[model samples]
Target: MRHNKWWLLVLALVLGLVLTACSGASDSTEDDNAGENESAEEKVLRISSPSDIPTMDPILAEDNVSIQYTDTVYEGLYRLAPEGEIVSGIAKKDETEVSEDGLTYTFHLREDAKWENGDPVTAQDFVYGWQRAINPDNKSFYANYLMSGKIKNAAEIYAGDLEPSELGVSAPDDYTFVVELEKPVPYFESYAAFPTFLPMNKEFIEEQGDDFALKPENMLSNGPFKMTEWNAEAGWKLEKNETYWDAENVALDGINVKVIKEPDTALSNYEVGELDRVTLYGSQVNDNQTSPEYNSLAETSVFWMKFNQESKTASKYMQNENFRKALAKAFNKQAYIDVVYGNDSTPVNYFVPKGFVKHPETEEDFQQGSDVLAYDVEAAQELWATAKQELGFEEVTLTFLSGDSDVAKSISEFMKGELESNLEGLTIEPNNVPWSQQLEIMRNKEYELAVSGWGPDYKDAISFVDLWVTGGENNDIAYSNKEYDALVNAAKGELATKPVERFEAMQEAEKIALEDAAIAPIMQRKTSVLAKDYVKGMDSLNPFGNDYSFKYVDIVK
Candidate 1:
């Protein structure tokens, strides 16, 4: 009896042990599958910007930051898709009609489209916005720019030769908007997607007057995101607009941006999982090239040193063509890029960036077979000698203007060193200022030499070549060439319908500008960025327009 009792106890203990082991295995399996059964978390993306957006008004917004922010908060007739395709915004794409000559476009706006204030978006808003842009009294910088040569009577309106009411855009009814073009523009859809072409409510704008777009409450959004918070010193926050027409398809809940000027600080935040995206430069790029998060993206932006040929500037030497050529060739572009950017950015001698646009018929890259302004040290010295003799001065000093950002400072310092070393008795004073101040100085032509850059507003060589045209709005350098202007104008006017000839004309225009040394070409920018692995659906880095479209971006784990 005692032996049987002991055997029973032993059997009980073994069963207990087996049950404990089985329970442990079950808990492990549940732990492994826990995430699958849990509810999804809210999708919010965090990003960093180097500086605050310059302005909120699309008509006056010239910088990329302002354009990017404005594009998200406002809707044009057309919008660029995530993959850079022209997509419908307020206007229904399939219902739109075009004249056989491609000179007129009639758009039917969607009835359901409403502004953030719950007012129905109408075709008259577009007419009013376009007319305001062309109104000479408004002094919009981009008025006669992209619109003048294309939109019928736009140039005349901007020049005060005609009334703004006669500017070619009309609203027949509440929903029908008609535009008359001066000529056939192949890239008209691309232009329509730009921020400058966005609609504005005349009543709302007039009510706000000078206070318009200065604060978040003063604005209304008609796009996928709405600005919920804006603090220039801190940054801005954008939340998904529940009132947006296509809000159901918009994936991101919100995007939080911070203005972090220091790359080190930005990277540290990224490492701690505080930031999902950040741009890196110089040594930061070199250190993280092997990381999975690293990405080197080629962009359409090209930076150059713009010489102020105005006689009032301190550097009187810039008026001489040989002096400009000498300054253009004095530096080693490759070395400067390597020392400052430390990425895949290539040294370029031409203003138009490579791989940006292609020939219409041959489909060859636009920069192909184009003349290269070769860097010849010997030639540069000879040009400097001639310039000095012509100016009757053995020594010259110039102020070099640039932004105060770390990357900008590095670039300016390198150029200053190179110029001082290469050219005898040449002194380059590096003057680093805030971005806004730099822009103001450039606009007033208040600097001797300034580092400036241009990114495409549309995917065409004309975007780059048109800047140096005689009396062009963007021609802040005071550089003008009649031949260059003729070529560029032909590309925009008479050759508008001829794709190949237009392309060639722009190419020839760029060559003329470079030969005259209107601006010293530097390296085309290739941005180095780091993004978290869980961040998804941001597939396209646009060569034109806004860099990112957050509508399709999703966070998945």
Candidate 2:
């Protein structure tokens, strides 16, 4: 899935605008005194983010909220550039040499890069990071995907039968790193850019213990910016690291990120010239789109309904295939897109959002097929009837759990009304919970039906299709298909050697999953950013979300 955190990204952009506005307004009062030092240049840039930095430890941080913050503070061997191309970061430039069987990889690292604390960044850092992640005791969900079968003995290591050192990653010296894989991976370089694979400073992690990521002092940054201040409730700030090897190329002096979840409050701050950028939603889009300040940008992300077939609390009704299909059929996607998103979004038919992947061979555009469980009252009623008869029930009630966002609430209400009115002998209950609680429920498979969205980890079709692959950690829906799983596994095995073949296999896997109605995909989300005309260099190479490079951003005098 793409690392597109729409809400969180919007919050960050809005907060950037807010901080700029606040400083601008305050600057007027100190203009006389500040004018003299104006020639000194800006040393900090302020940004806003909606979610808190969950963890500073890359191995433990999996969500986009944490990934976005970490991306600025940590440097990977390779980093994605603004043009969505991979560039050398810590490695300088790695040489890939495939083994005879095409299952082994050896990477040569740069010898000069050093950690923020002045310790040399050796290939051992990468080896240690990989070991820590796959260690069974750590139980990192991301580690399962990142290491998994890629490294020899990794699966066994994760199962606790083998020592962490037994994993396939090894640093022969200070600069040579070798990786052994159980199968060939085509997107391995892209995978290296992911947060889970970023190197960590062992000494710092050990010293800080559990509080390593709690404050700026406890952490050591390896990326363009270093953590300066992190007020749990207020926000976090990043100051440009002058010691960064690529510091000369970095534009912003610093960036401050605020956590603001409420759209109206964010918009109010933006309108009052307290924010440099803000994101508008549904009706707010209409209110702001016509405004002189509005600047909307679309991104590739999909928000949809996830059915927990393995739910312990509400499993009986949700596990029923007919019930799941009925719920999907009851939703009018176009109506939701029209009424909920308007011109700001487009309805999604497939689970993988459009613009996520390109054909490996032809490089042709792959559009989402019309295999959606489209809204049809009559069809929904028919499916519901069949489900009622099969279950030998007079009535069935199921709850839809979602985060407590205004948009989530509205969509839940819309779904409830649609299902209740269209399907007989069915009750649709809506449960609104905090995002943290909602994530817990989804992870534990505690909800019957839940509202959720996934952004790609890398720009690949496998990222999305892998969700339903049997026991995938991200498979909150408890969807399991042996054939689908086999196809995905096969694709993963052949990804490097047979790129076109792998894509075809994945396409077949997606078709099978969708035909089963494993999950209902709703709309493709567009990230709308309302920025003041003067903010420039907002674009960064980070594929995860909006990149805050305030170095090049300047307030027009």
Candidate 3:
């Protein structure tokens, strides 16, 4: 952490607003600005989050908090545009070429792009970063989860059957980089815009060894802003990178963020000019819509409780799909939203959030055009009875792992009451844990059931749908089905180039999972924000969970 006046609050508001998010990059369709323009100077754009950044290493980032800090410093081949389009970042759009078959992508690194340390950013930098991410020895959570089969030999490398050098990405020269994918992936360019695809400074990384990315001195930035100070508990600061390739277009002079956990305190700070933006959660949302600063945006994220088929305790009945269906149908989705979220979101019966994807030919919403798994209480009871009869257990206590936050606990308690009352002889014992702890618990697959969500990393439905593939990295439920894997594989392989087939395959994959009760779809999320009038150009629709870009942000009086 750098010793300077810093704004670590970015994490506080960032986590509060974006980290809690479960889905990814959103299309910009809701902005009401008539080009009033949001800009800042001399000082930074002030935002608050409830937590500190967990890590700055892109390969190591699992949560949005870590991605926020690292993403600010790292420039990838592509960057996400305001409307959720793919724009060139380190690699210029004109210089990039895709093979006729879409199996290969070639990127030409811009000569003007340089690291914050004045070293020229090169093609090999990307090669090294890709290798490091896919290297099983580095233990990157996103490596196999995000890229595994997408990149040639990536799965083999993670499984120790092949070396990192075998991965299909390479740089023939400092200015030219080429990537070979296993198949045609229309969303691959959008994926390249993600942090996991960012380049690394090889020399600096090897010099710092394990200490790389831990401090300002050890980190390097090629993005529009560079970190000048980072205090884990105190705060962090980011200054505009003067040498950035597109620095002239950047608006902010610097960004100072602080950490504030309480909604009232954060609101108080925002009122006093101590913070520029704050997200109001739970009950804090009511009675604030009349404020000039109040703004709300529909989020692509969704919340669901994953049923663990491999229970550590004696709740083996979870392995039964009938039991899973019973639990899914027993919940009141609308009531869940009204109670847990103060009705800020909509009840969703499917895994993929609505408006996330569109039909190739008709342009209709992909989710709206598909078949849905119906939710009903009467059908739930029959499924529960049949499940119990098969398992020889009249009653079962399902252990649920959830967040320790006030709203999280309340939601869990609310669901427990609803499930127990609706389905007789059922017990839900929720073990509330901190957000970080809860993630680890689920990652380790140490819980019987857990509430978790995925924000898409890209615009495609596959971004969230791929998470449920058999043995995929985020599938902590220990749920697996050959049919599910087949449908998903078809979507990513044979159906990729054919947009209609691809959409249909994904629709089928989602159908198979939902029908089997792989996870309970509660509701799609929408965040009510007390956005400062001066805060402009911050992105809120990116489905990738990067809620905003600070480069063009401003704070005008």
Clash count for each candidate, listed in order shown: 0, 25, 34
Worst 10 residues of 1 by lDDT: 1-10
Predicted model with the maximum lDDT: 1
Q: How many angstroms is residue 379 displaced in model 3 relative to the true structure, after the best TM-score fit? A: 3.6
RMSD in Å for model 1: 16.8
Q: Which of the two, 1 or 2, has more lDDT?
A: 1
Per-residue lDDT of candidate 2, residues 1-557 (tens digit) = 23322211112221111000000000001111222442446733433444454566766655555665676788778776663567787875547566888677777777667778878788888998888888878767667755687778988998889999998888889888788888877767766676677787788888888787778999888788898877774676677787787788776666656665566766766666556666565677776677776654454555667788887766776678887788888878777765554546676767665665778778765554765476677887788888888878887788888656565577678788877878877688999775555656766788887766655566666666776778776676878889999898888775557888888888888888777789877776555556777666553223333233233344543
Model 1, runs deviating above 4 Å: 1-40, 369-372
All candidates in order of lDDT, best leading: 1, 3, 2
State the displacement of the C-alpha of residue 544, model 2, in Å, after optimal TM-score superposition.
Answer: 5.6
For 185-294, candidate 1 gives per-residue lDDT tens digits of 87787778877788998989999999988888888898899988888746777888888899998888777777666667777777766677777767888999999988
Task: State model 1's lDDT.
Answer: 0.73
> Residue 531, candidate 3: how far off, in angstroms?
1.2
What would the per-residue lDDT of candidate 3 be over residues 31-92, giving only the tens digit for each residue?
A: 12212223432545766555556678877766655665666677899876665567888898
- State, as a TM-score between 0 and 1, how close model 3 is to the true structure: 0.89
Model 1 residue 448 CA deviation (Å) reads 1.2
